[model samples]
Target: MLRASLLASVAATPFFITAATAQDYFDIGEIIVSGGLSPIEANAFGRASNVITAQEIERRGLTTVQDALRALPGVSVNGSSNSFTQVRIRGGESGHTLILIDGVEAAGGDGEYVLSGLQTANIERIEVLRGPQSVYYGSNASTGVINIITRKGAIGDTYTATLEVGAATTATAFVSRRTERGGVALSFSHLDDRGYDQSGDGGEKDGLERTTINLSGDYLLTDDWKVGFTLRGSDEEADTDPSPFGATDADSYVVDDPDEFSTRDERTASIYTEYEMMGGRLTHRLSFNKTKYKSTYSSGLPVTRESEAVKYRLSYGLDGRTVADTDHLLSLLVENKKDSSDDNPLYAREATSVALEYRGSFANGLDVQAGARFDDNTVFEDATTWNVGLSYQIPDTGVRLHASAGVGVVNPSYFELYADAYGYSGNPNLTPERNESFDIGAEFAILDGRGSFDVTYFNETLIDEITDVATGPGAFSFVNQAGKSDRQGVEVSGNIQATDALNLRLAYTYLDAKNPDGSVEIRRPRHELALGATLDTFGGRGSVSGDIRHVSGNYDSQFWQWPAPTVELPSYTTVNVAAQYELSDTITLNGRITNLFDDDAVDAWGFASRGRAAYVGISAKF
Candidate 1:
């Protein structure tokens, strides 16, 4: 299995490698940073994790991060449009997952990051760590973490560019440069889609126009010091439909209104410095991150809403070998964050946190990890979280066992605490939600490392869940629930190098999510399955890959109906195929077809999904 190969490689490397330098080789997926304070090998990690390498993204012709994540186990992605995509994991709410870019928080004041705005240009790799992770990442990490790592400077100068045209009148241009000491990347994408009638009837097209820009660079100050920065911005104008606020017919809520449109602008930036000390035994890092969001709605009162978030963090790590064939790492972190919005000038929240983590690896094929964190908040009750895990490889047997348990916390979002819109009131007395979770998994290597299979079972319970309650006619307020919500699931995956020229992969998930009253949760499918195959053609100079995903047994609510009626959504299946051929040493030709069969399956009752579409593109390296 690949995990065995990764472990063997890590066992041969040095005790510690600075995080800044590790980025140079992130494509290997041998070291993972999001799972712990310090980088750890995949074999030693006790978490259910998945990685999407840059090569895979390019091979699949994925333009957005959300597209790359759609087929991953335990992950579900859906949206009404390109500007409102949401990602959920393991039956957890979208806000329960933390989004990170180069160790910087990418979420807004609402504690959620819309995945549609994140492009794949200049991305080195993506890491998904499943389970409660508040002990390592603080709030908004009640279920998992998605860490997006960008490409770093290489040994020499290099330049690359790509141009593509696709369905929906989409056009994209990307360019990047890498130097010995530093590197920079830039990308721009524009989309003008003549969307379908979202109401499932003939009507005006709900079109949309969106533009995105991403920039990043880093420079080495010295042999042991480095500085880097990233900037991302996006603008979107989307035609929306009228709600059922005052409509006489409940089913007319999804009808399109040409005059009802919304505009949004989002920006995020981060700067950081890293310095190694004590001859590489100790490392220190300092970073500052900021995100801003602005939106205007033309449906009701031409209302404008704006929010901003700022975070400052500092951390130190010490690495050493205390015993023969053993390694130990200890880390400490301190951070301060503030979230505010112009809608409520007097409503802002600040939080300070301190955390400690320890990781140990021994020659007896056992790895252990533990972490704890304490958070101080100004608006809600304080929280403390802890986690522990271990992984062991049975010697002489091709089996590995892993298990982890953790406590997670999520503070109420600013909107939930201060918003006074559409007859909904905020609840300042609401407390943070708490979660307890555990998972156990085992992996088996078969066919002499040519094939691998794994299965895991996870269980979680959430307490003090924030929910809306009706107070009076057309009035509601947020409040903590009295009972706990339960979630349990099983995940299975397999990989096989079937032949020297072909590879196959499969993943399936079975989930059971329940509300406090033991009722089925909405939007979480009970069964999801994905199958993929890749073939190397032209004697390794060209490649072709195809993927299929199926989702079934999902339910959603019709919010426009009084007392919101729970409805089951129809199952969906999507197919995508991509191929790339190397024209020369510096040029490549590529293309892809999405939704090959044009199955018009809607994730939501009133939302219409895209049909079969094809794209062609060219890329060059110099």
Candidate 2:
């Protein structure tokens, strides 16, 4: 394993970037919104999580949401180098990581979900909760959850616009206005990239284009009543690539076929109301959410696939802190959701769930939390899940210890249950995959809150996994496998402020993911490392930052092709750097370079990675 030496080398480089100058840190606060039913201080939570703010995005010159996610703990991405793709947490499949836009689930029925199209134009912050969250998020949260919160209009009028040109061209604009009783914000962004070639031999560049728009508004109807709505939509189109079958009839990817292309349209809408009752000790929230998605892929030949899904969700939640004074909290949630699609019976499914949670803090610096949920699915039997956690802080010191455990379940997808293609048939009796996960960790900070460290050990076992099995001669169908997979690992992360204006950060993951047959899971790096640094430079008027990532090779197999067998997927490393300069009171200049080493490594054993590239942009506001 090329893990130890390589990882150590990368981890040690950040220290050298420490600046000699001392500066002040941007104070945000030690708070996390997704770790609990409500907002909680980071030091009081007995779980592990990472937060990325919009200011950090701008400082780092992160162009896409995917780029930002790759830096987080336990995130892995595939595809999107040329076309749409999937991203998973830890060693789980893409479907195991539940994605939310403003607390509303966005995954749809067997098509390109909006995961690839989100433009980060209106995002205020992103919260990543690692480990099983099915008790709170319900379906498809067996591994982790990514909650994206967008900006509500500020208390005053604001407007900003930016335009960039490079290997990819981008445009972004935002406007907002607010009064004492109400506020509204609107954002629009477009990206067009003449991306790298996708063919094995490299012939034509697979271009991609996307446009996204977001609108959000909130109104305070009365002293203790408020209502809000969030709306988002995007359009995307991409050029071609081929399959691994090399010009054979079995090759569905149509290799190097520039004539092959795909198009997608997606929309998400949600509205919510909040009311305070019982002398301000109790509060209730009700929300309605819906997502509409459609996608089509066509090749030069007479082959094309079109799919669509519309999902609707309704939820009501209650929260109170009067159970045992302000030290105790209680939460209740009820949700109903449905997915519908024409020409696909399995896509027509419904689910309902109820969840309850309680948290309390003791005078001795001890915190306890527990939650339970019951879910009923139209296509599967009812299931119950629960989670518990504990946190303790050593008095007067910046040391804290924590532990958490949870159960998770994921219902079968529409394509897995009903798609009939390539000599395979869907199985109506398929059941959901169940998981039990456990995690323990400790966090400590020294040097007057300038340095911090965290170490966590996590393990998960999956049961009743749905897989294809031979049903008859020359035919295969979906069935439940008793034991599917296991994932266990250690995560280490830290940050140190070497100087007042310079900070160094590092994160590493050691993963041991195995299939039921004792083989390693595909596309999961056994060892992953990330290193970063931010420094005040150019006379304090400009700042510069850079990050490095290293991945150890894993295993993969090309299904639906001849000689399908697990093969080694090579590992690689890439670096990114960015610089910003304030040109004036209302204008700023920014520049960035991606893949600094020009690795051009094959990404996830499919497409070629972008080589060394640079871009410069300017932003203006009045």
Best by TM-score: 1
What's model 1's lDDT at 225? Answer: 77
lDDT of 2 by residue, 457-533 (tens): 99988888888888788888888887769999988888899997898888888889999999888878788888999
Q: List the residue pairs that clash in candidate 2.
A: 23-500, 23-501, 242-255
Instruction: Give the poorly placed runs of model 2, Cα more than 4 Å off.
Output: 1-29, 110-114, 244-254, 298-325, 343-347, 558-561
Relative to the unseen true structure, what is the C-alpha lDDT of residue 438 in candidate 2, on a scale of 0 to 100?
A: 89
Q: What is the lDDT of residue 284 in candidate 1?
A: 68
lDDT of 1 by residue, 489-597 (tens): 9988888999998989888999999999988888888898999998999998899999999989989887766677778788989999999999999899988998899
Clashing residue pairs in candidate 1 are: none
Cα deviation of 346, candidate 1, in Å: 0.9
lDDT at residue 355 of model 2 (Cα atoms) = 84
C-alpha lDDT of all candidate models, in order: 0.75, 0.72
Q: Assess candidate 1 and give its TM-score to the true structure.
A: 0.90
TM, every model: 0.90, 0.89
